[model samples]
Target chain A: MNNELLAVRSVSKAFGGVQANQEISLTIPSGKIIGLIGPNGSGKTTLFNSIVGYHPVDQGSVRFQGKEITKMLVPQIARLGLLRTFQQTRIFSGLSCIGNMQISAPVVRSGLKSLFTKFPIDDMEDIEDILAFVGLHSKRHLLAGQLSFGQQKLLEFAMALIAEPKLLLLDEPTAGINPTLINGLIDRLRVANQELGITLFIIEHNMRVIMNIADHIYCLAHGQLLAEGPPDKIQNNQTVIDAYLGAN
Target chain B: MRAWHYLIILLLAVSAPFILPDYRTQLAFLWLMVILALSWDIMGGQMGYNSFGNIIFFGIGMYVCAVFQRDSGLEYFQGLLLGMGLGGLAAVIIALIIGNALLGMRGHYFAIGTLGLSVVAGELAGGWDYIGAGSGLTPPLYPGEISERNVFFYFLFFVWAGITFVSLWWVYRGRFGLAINAIRDNEDKAEAMGIYTTRYKVSAWTLSALFLGVIGGGVGNLIGFIDPKDVAFSGATFGVWMILMAILGGKGSLWGPVIGAIIFHVTQELFWTLFLGWQRVALGLLIVLIVVFFPEGILGWLRQRYPHRMRDANNSTEKNKLNK
Candidate 1:
């Protein structure tokens, strides 16, 4: 089996005079933990954005589940079970943590009729379960804004969980979190992958976390793909070291 | 706050004309203000659209209804009923047509775009001689005593406003409310979360237009004349008042606009009586006070002050749910 869930072919995007991603190509196989690493402004985030339909690409195409999706809008792509999380974490701060989850319920996006219907009561159990999984159950009723930064990130993850996406693109999931929380987050990400059978494509700056968590890794420098291999090979790749990891 | 509380308020509202016959007109005006604020809140507060041209629907409604009564030659009551329904339908069509274009703009762009739309609507109505142009249109007279006319229109507004409130309450309790609130909090994220943001935004605007248009017909009849700018499309008065009232009470909460409308209408009426020619200045000062001290509005301020009281009520309900 090809096992490819997402395929990006020579995708190029430029913002005015700046080339954010140039002829970038990659694949996310089904049920795999894929990691993207790059120096600042190296177009790691841009690639994620392009794949998730945040912006139209200047060149190239993105295919999800063997279907062309380069021209699809964000909501349409998301409805196809491709969802993403932001680097800064975008929870509905005005709503309670539970409310955020409730709003993110799959039914909300299911169809026109679902909009007028009350949120299904049975979803509450699932929400509470995921909240507890993220250790946010106790604070479910509190405004999401009141949560700590790490908690907010967890809430965002919980929201994505509620959507029941097939492939989730996480942008810098652990940048602002402390080490302990990072460890916890990594564990949940693992559980979400292995237990839930969801595929993950993550952008990470944390060397240790990405190395340990991702089965395969892609490294970018200056909007160009620098290296791609299993984690240990990417770790040993001289080009990646020279461009991003620095000489030690 | 409770079933009984709503019941008491409804009882008072239903009995207001009889109890205060002298202030019947003023009471009717209160309901008008309520409808305006509530409708505006759906887009401005909930969906974060902040459209300034909602008055376009009201204007269209007034004109369509009056024109129908004039040209259709139907009896007064039949014409009025049919006219109001046609008015609402016309407003909805206009909303759908314009919303697709205007709703594409975000933030200040959307607001300015809608404002321009409002101005353009007024100008169009002013130039169109079919519905009286700058001269204004007059609907057929009410077929009853003046007192009966007041009571009839009063009930018309009361029932309409009640329907508005109840409908909003229903909408806000469901997934639609959550979806719009998500859009308000963050549009990009909302889209990425699979919310067709444009669809929701247009739908929200359409809901406001639907209500505003229907009410506009009744208001045109109540006022007896519809000047293009001053009456039918009074952007300066009705449009601005709706936004201000929503802000004054609270934007996001269900009761905020209602509370804000009641307080603002009563206060504005008082200012008209007390300040006379200076009422505009008094109103301006009131707006400043609301923004300065209660930027979050009265409900937000109350929530900030007694967070636990609200949370406790929530907790009790949640605990009962858990027990069940």
Candidate 2:
């Protein structure tokens, strides 16, 4: 039994003549934090989209726990315990912090019963717990739109965590966030991975954040995997340094 | 709180026909408007998808009942049931096609698609002669004298009450409401959180259409006359009015649009009777004023004034708190 939770095998995607992803293959283990870093237009978000079923792979296979899910819709893939966040925080602006979490909470499909009944299952406690974990318990009633950008990012994390996903794909979790909040978010991510044992595949431009938390790293440039190794090894790799640091 | 609220509404509904004047049969008309507004709110307000073609369901309801009575001599209630079935069937098809296409199109395009559908439906109705073409079929009057109009009025009241209660029950307590609200707030996020947004949107359309259809049939039977102009114009006006009420009452709050429909219809009736030809202009101006100053609507204003009382965390919580 392979302990791999997700495997993207030789996946290729092209838009018109532009190849967005080129034969990218990666395996995410059940309890690991893997960092994905790349220069702009390196297909980091594209790969994330493909894994979460936002974008269809032109030629490849995506397996989740040994089942091929390449053709699954985004919601179907999400229901199967693989979830992804957007590059921009996708918190429900109209919903409260807790309401956002509740929307993502897993409930059995009860058709009309789900539509017409407000059953108070143990979900309320689950919402409160997730809020506390994300340090948003105090702001549970606040509209998500009213939260600061950093707070919204935290809310987004809490929303994802409420689903108790087996594999979490986080796109630029630290991007546009202040350094102070970034550290707190990183801590939460660490806790989510370590304590909850949720596998995290993150895309981040912040090398410091990535190197600090990632158990392993994959670097991409121009839709191709440039390097893959432990953080120290990736830090010294010529391709990663040249592709990422050269531009900066 | 919810139980008490419904109890009060039920008491009022049960006593309305006795306390209110007979000439105010128009009040039943207003109740019909409330049902229509609530139906629109479920799809547009709660689901966050603006549908201009909602009138099609209303028109289908009206025509189905009208044609059934004219061709088969079906009783008013039987015609109403047929209309509802037709509306649901039409809605399931339209929702599957339009809902799927519109779900992927954001904002303006979605609105335009519905607008196009409404136009096409109206044109089709106008061209069909067996269904009365430009002229509409009329139902047989209540099988009694003019003095018995109040009896029919009471019947309409119960029908309206039943619909309003059912809609409120489903929308406030059901999983459908949760799914629809989730889709409304952030569709992409909802999808990524395991919501089938397209399916829910289509289901909302189907449900809303079913209600609108039955109400349309009831309204047709109430008037005992149907014409293309009445069906098309009234349907279109009600569609617009539904949006206004949803905005005025605050969308996503189940009772908001109902209150809006009542207030708006009552005010319009008073104004139209008193001001005559100037009534429409006055109503138009009022809509503008309401949108400009109190964009959240009356319920929204009330909620704002008393935030703690209406803290559902889904909608109006922020607006209500801000108003205070």
Best by DockQ: 1
lDDT of 2 by residue, A186-209 (tens): 898999999998999999988899
DockQ of each: 0.83, 0.63
Q: On a 0 to 100 scale, what is the lDDT of residue B305 in model 2?
A: 83
lDDT of 1 at B291: 97
RMSD, every candidate, angstroms? 1.9, 3.7
Docking class of 1: high
> What is the RMSD, in Å, between candidate 2 and the native fold over all Cα?
3.7
**How accurate locally is residue A13 in candidate 2, as Cα lDDT from 0 to 100?**
91
Per-residue lDDT value at B214 in model 2: 63
The numbered model that scores best in TM-score is 1
| TM-score (C-alpha) between model 1 and the true structure | 0.97
Candidate 1 lDDT by residue in tens digits, B119-218: 8888999998888989999999999998888889889999999999999888876778878988888898899899998988888989999999999999
lDDT tens digits, residues B176-218, model 2?
6667877887888888988877777878887777777666766
Task: Give each model's whole-structure lDDT.
Answer: 0.90, 0.78
